[model samples]
Target chain A: MPKILIVDDDPNIRQYLAALFEDHGYLTVVARDVAEALQTAQDERPDLITLDLDLPGEWGPRFYRALSQEPELKSTPIIVISAMPGSRYAIGNAVASFTKPFDREELLKTVGETLDL
Target chain B: MAKTVLLLEADSSHADALKIYLGRKQAEVHVAATDEKARGLLASRDFDILLGNPYGFGEACPGEVKRHKLANPLLQVIIFCPRALMDQAMDDFGPLAANYLDLPLNSKALGLALDHAEKCIATEKKLAAYSQRLSDLHDAQSLYQQLFNEVPCYITVQNKDLRITDTNAKFKRDFGHEVGGFCYEIYKHRSSPCPECPVAKTFYDGGSHGTEEVVTSKAGKQYNVITQTAPIKDENGQITQVMEMSTNITQIRQLQDHLSSLGLMLGSMSHGIKGMLTALDGSIYQLETGLQKEDRTRMAAACEQIKEMTERIKKMVLDILYYAKSRELQYALTDVRELAETVVSMISPQARHKGINLVTELEKDLGIIEMDPNWMQAALINFLDNAVDACLFDPKEKEHRVVFRVSPRDPETVCFVIEDNGTGMDRQTRETLFTLFFSSKGSQGTGLGLFIANHVVQQHGGSITIRSELGEGSRFEVCLPRVKTDHARLNAVPQPHQNVAF
Candidate 1:
């Protein structure tokens, strides 16, 4: 099964994605913060990663920098979810973007389209 | 003029004798025996006094006396009743009992009662006049009280000694108990009286006075108090009291100050930023020119310079955004010193690259200030980053240095100072430092640094001022109001990257 890494500071968000992806026949791994997400991305080698912009530990710019600088995560087709005013989060690198309170079906479709699965 | 009396008697012989007696006494007498004859005599003539007999009467003597009185309550009633009938007459007609005499009346006793009635009438007129005057005075007093209480501002009556003698409901609500206290002590929280108090001037000169004074409450919150005093005059034109009204203007004054400073800063920043943009446009032209001349080396260098200059301008634009977003934008208590330190560290890399020594002197024992932490940090960063840039090392210089100092001005105010020992500003530049787009650094600086810095300092109920001279360096001072409220713990933590600067 294709694996998806869902990284968010909020526990509810992590749990909801985990349940949704598992029900949709994809293996899911959840990380609570940027540091944990980086570790999980390396250890699990997920097919795709969904990151929240406003994380508890490190915020928008720092999280985006962490992804671009990391060798393993650089080409992982990362998507950023933010409730921030703008739809895009640009730091040092390019990444797929989605505004927060996004629908589950849309999230899955974006993931499917990007991964071609 | 002749004295007249009318006698109505049933016996004709007695009527003739009574008429003769009255006529011999130099009084005109009219006598009528029958009721019909009496009515005919009354219809043709007016009589001042009526004398009636007890015997041969249709109604009783008491009833006869009452009928005469009913015709005129002011009329004098003299009853000619038998001595035995006097008590019965008094019992039946007490209100009409002006005087009673036995048949063959004693005129001396009648003369005394008439004198007493005349005195009573004069006393009644005087009493009526005095009662009307009292009612008028009552109406005036009620109107004065209504006006005093209904006024919008806090109003009070103060005696010559400056003691509040009376106060309205608004006065009581604002100054706690308004009456029975010194005006200065209650309103200004001052133990000693104010120097040259306007209210005192009114009391002494019997003239009105008004002034705006800064006052502090018991809790030490400051206020701009506007007081108006009008002398309350007595009938002799002497000032017996003073009426005072006060309104608090602390917030309004602060807001006005903020607006003026923001206006100045925005004006200067806009001018400086535009000037920098112009320079950037010039440099880009030069780069294009160099390329057209087939000078690859010069074009490459110009492009590098342009890129660096553009990056600096971009940073300035970000500073302006951060400054505008958080300057007095309202938030909970945040650790201002920690935020200052964060900015210091954030700019440390740049400081290191420029070979400038960067230092922070943040006081650990500092009160938390109510601020948006992200915005406050951004504001501090603008100052620090600008200072580091200005303190860049000259070719022959041993070491360039920039310093950041955060000190407590009591527990309620924190002072942050950013000083640099680079090529400092001249008088003209310092004067126009905060003017919009008025940068001295040409294309290199957007001139928004100090402008945004002033705005940030002002937002926290603090002030920002710059002191600089050509080549000596510049120092920017920021004063931030301290918070004594309960959100102190949350403010002390250093949260990273939530920095307000773009």
Candidate 2:
């Protein structure tokens, strides 16, 4: 089974996305902010990562940069999800970007394709 | 007029003869025989001409003539002397005397000398008057120059060729004091004249003209100026030069820009707000369905979503309140039914244009409510406008209608209800409807209308509630107290989000 990392500042959003992916039979790991996201990515080495742009202390872009620097985690696929408008172009290396209140079917489909690749 | 003359002589017969001859010539002659009498006469009376026998009066005559000349610089004096004594007389009194005669005076020569003295006095008086007038003109010119320089506005005098002839101190300070420079070059840094220049218009029509212009200074700073130009005509009544005066309005323009950009900032912020609303809606949808399924794990997860969305909404509302606190409300005792009728009249035309049926149902004698009529009217307009937009956005094939109704809830409260048969909101939308920046119209909505409408109603000590279904319609009820209440007490009412229910 493929494992997914959910990174968001909102605990509820993290929980909601975790439940959504877990219902689809993908194992889910959650991080409440950018700092924890970095630590979780190294420990779990998930197949894909879902990121929220706005986070406490550090933002998602800085975390993506740090994650890309790690030799072992450099190839992990990232899907950006944010409440900020025009945050689709926020990360250059992310495989896909989805705005907040995104369709659940679309998000799950993008996740499936990214992990398959 | 007879000319007055004083004659000094020691010989009595000669003095009497001379006085008779002068009197016949239209002269008033006063004879002073002794030096003492002559001195007295000279002191007491004004004489146009003085004739003295210097030999008879001895050395005192020359001294007396000098004294008379000192008293009246324009006085004319004639002395009688023998040819042998002429040289000595000329040495002592020549500068003071108008003329000199031989010891026995020739009457014709004496008359000629008196005529010359009268002409000298007339010229002196005329010269004095001309000098006084010249001094007055100089003073007036100085005053004009001072006023031109001290005026607070920039002023410049330009000739027919558009070259600056003169500039006031203020203009000189802003644009360097270079006379004969081209007006356009100095004022606007342009090589050629500006189009529709007020100064050029004044020159062509010979009438005053006014315009607004943005001017750049030598220091490279910009100023918004209102310029007025008038013709400066020459003595021939021809327009010779144009005088332009300008007042700076840079700060006022800056204030207007600041206000407009504030409006723009509010517009841009709506996009971020719309995204947040969508997220909240998604969360709520998950929560309600989880409850229906009775899944414990899903219910726990939905509870977390509820808490997070609630906190974000609270912060957004507080931010809106802080921004709107500056606008003071004007309150009056307004008839609720009349206000509703007025709003309907105002919006009916637009509703008809959109092919939506707008109807009003008012409860007669629905008494007055103390409220800000303008703000309350705006709230009604906002609700009606949303109703119209909802109808337009609806994709259904059914007949669309929006009805505005007003009635007394009780003796003390009035309720305004608006119902629209359009694309209504779902449970998730209804739950977060009154939260700031939540709009179903997507990019077309600023997300501020309903937020502002809710705020206005809240200020009137009123409450707003909505009931809707996904495809059927939505109904909004605004209940306001008819009697006046202390604004402080109204503010004490809990925030709107707490009162809203799904």
Best by TM-score: 1
lDDT (Cα atoms) of all candidates against the true structure: 0.67, 0.78
Docking model 2 quality class: incorrect
Error of 2 at A48 (Å): 36
Taking the tens digit of each residue's C-alpha lDDT, what string does model 1 give over A1-115? 8899887654434545665577567899987566778788889988888876655425656665776777867777777765443546354343567654555577778877877
Candidate 2 clash total? 0
DockQ of each: 0.01, 0.10
**Lowest-scoring 10 consecutive residues by lDDT in candidate 1 chain A?**
A85-94
Candidate 2 lDDT over B1-502, as tens digits, reads 3878888888999999998888887888899998789888988988877887766775666776787788887667888878888898889886788788886788888778778778876887788788898899899989999999998889999987899999999999988888999988987899999999888899899989998889887766668899999899889999999999999887667555545544664666665565556556656767766777877776675666566556446545544454333355677888777788899998897688668999889987887788889878878888898888777667587789999999888888889999999888889878876665566654334456676788778777788889999788899999888865564243432332222111
lDDT of 1 by residue, B1-502 (tens): 1456667788889788777766765667888788766767766666656666644566644465467568755455566577887787777667665566676566666455544444444564567688889999889888878877777777878887788899987666656763688888887877878898888898778777889987654444456878888888889988888888877776567555545655665655553454344345435645665667777875775665566557667776676665443332557677666677678778887677557888878777766777767667767787787777666522236578899898887777788889988767777777877765555443235556666666555545567778987778889888777753333332222232233333
RMSD (Å) of each candidate, 1 decimal: 20.4, 20.8
Regions of model 1 farther than 4 Å from truth: A1-117, B1-125, B159-161, B187-196, B203-205, B215-228, B245-263, B266-349, B357-371, B386-502
lDDT of model number 2:
0.78
Model 2 spans > 4 angstroms off: A1-117, B1-18, B21-47, B51-61, B67-71, B251-502
